[model samples]
Target chain A: MVSSFLSGLLGVWVIGVSTIDAFEFEDEVERLRYSGLIAEFRCPKCLNTNLSGSDAPVARDLRRTVYRLVDEGMTDDQVRRYLQARYGDFVLYDPPVRANTWILWFGPPFLLLAGILVLRRIGSRMTRVSLSDDERARLEVIRKQ
Target chain B: MKRAVFFAPFIGFIALVAILYAGFHLNDPSHLPSALVGQRFPGFELPELTSGKVLGHQTLLGEIRLVNVWATWCPTCLHEHTTLMDIRRATGLSIVGINYRDDGEKARRWLSLYGDPYDFTIVDANGDLGVELGVYGAPETFIVDADGIIRFRHVGDVNDGNWNREFLPILDSLTDG
Candidate 1:
């Protein structure tokens, strides 16, 4: 079946495909061929919940661009990288962040640290007395008796 | 010091907006762009595959119409075609079909084999129109009313409950007035 499908696809390609890049297949084949890839590629703008075109404009354009690249024999990662370079890392749903993306990479953790400091200050002011006399007595009993 | 005073609230609001926007993006479509219920229908223009003439989108003035995106090769589309025919016979609403990324001959054959309930079938062979309409997959159905507004859009196969349990009755209610 796979061989037959490949052969049939080859036959179809002979007519529609021109110089690899100049060729255009039947529309359904184009959409189906890319659907396998497009569905998995989450739209960076809409995040993970929506794939590259859940009625979102940016998602739609990305889907079109991804399909065009895939049809041109580019792997999914290659297509992703091309989009990343052109549109910045924001275009990729999950972009690898290193030295180049220190701001986006470390922003959340930095905010968390600030939040911890704020919470600590608030906690300090709200609750004052440390160890009560009764608590001291209990500790002394645990330590001695 | 002068700049900080004016920029304080503005910066805070900007941060809040960014976080909120990111959060919304992270959330489901049930939250983002969820105004199909009350707003105008999504208007789209797609040329026919063979003739290249435009189709549908104008008929959706105020009454509910089923806008289904389909193609010959999609198996899921075959499953829903029968359901669509049943809806056409029972409800009598305008059903517009967007033939996404398919050849003309195959599309005609697919319809000839099972049935064709589409009031108007738009051919979007290159996905340009599909891109414009924000179509990601085949067998997506949008409920548009006569006022050229989208009522609902269901991705994937349309189950029996989608019509018998949910949409049909809602469409029935809309047509009441």
Candidate 2:
């Protein structure tokens, strides 16, 4: 009963914290855009972490930059381009499809297809090797013995 | 078909291993390419290091120059100071400094003690301009052409080896052009 009551209290606290500290936005659409972009921008200082998830000093500064630019009525693409101009293409979690990245995009599916083909071949070969009638009779006699 | 399929996975695995080995051997993770390269330097208005006079990006234009991002707190800056002085004396190339995230008094004192090598140091106390320049660490040197396009950026201390081997060749090419 105590544990259940404590869990209920924790749930209420989490909800209150999340709801109360959501930065006030003049436009609801703008706030949504801010959250979306933060999740998309890579933290320059952290490996494989988005700006919204990082607590690095550079990440904090980048978040402020996003907020300032968004507040100034810059579109999402413009804000992205601004960061790209400084931090390079690496700052985008989803880099643009290009000649250099073609392998990264197509490699997994190709590998999967190859794997399936290999598995199918092996499965067929295993089925094709079903024991001959004499071999099967010998196995049955062995089991009886 | 069965034989080919059996061999395919091994061939593919070998190929993948070779590719992974080449990538790990060739690529340096610490050296990230700067988007600002081949682009114009970002504009900023910063106070000159001891002087109260304000300077902007325009002040750096009209000459082939080196803009070095440095700070009093960074020990690497001390190591690169003599090298910067040598470059200034040897090439007579304009070397501008960006004093990043430092107290004005401390920066001035640091320079005073070290024998200032910069043509003019811009005080970037808040590092706002450093952010604009995409500087993550101190002692990053940028080579800007007369047109103000950034040609090269050196991220670490500019010792004799880099100065002679890396920087000089590029400086010669830019100047020749």
After superposition, candidate 1 runs with Cα above 4 Å error? A1-145, B1-39, B42-44, B49-52
* DockQ of candidate 2 compared with the true complex: 0.47
Docking class of 2: acceptable
How far is B103's C-alpha from truth in model 2 (Å)?
1.6
Cα miss at A112, model 2 (Å)? 1.5
Instruction: Evaluate candidate 1 and give its CAPRI docking class based on DockQ.
Output: incorrect
TM-score of 1: 0.51
| lDDT (10s digit) by residue, model 2, range B1-177 | 667878887788788778878988785655567878898998888889878799988998899999999987889999899999888888889999999888899988988898888889998877677668777677899999999999998888899998889888989999898
Highest TM-score: give the candidate number.
2
lDDT for each residue of candidate 1 in A54-129, tens digit (9 for 90 to 100): 5554466666577678778787678766555433444445657778466567766766665666567657766885
Candidate 2 chain B minimal-lDDT segment of 10 residues: B24-33
For residue B107, model 2's alpha carbon misses the true position, in angstroms, by 1.0
DockQ of every predicted complex: 0.04, 0.47
- Give residue B56's lDDT in candidate 1 (0 to 100): 53
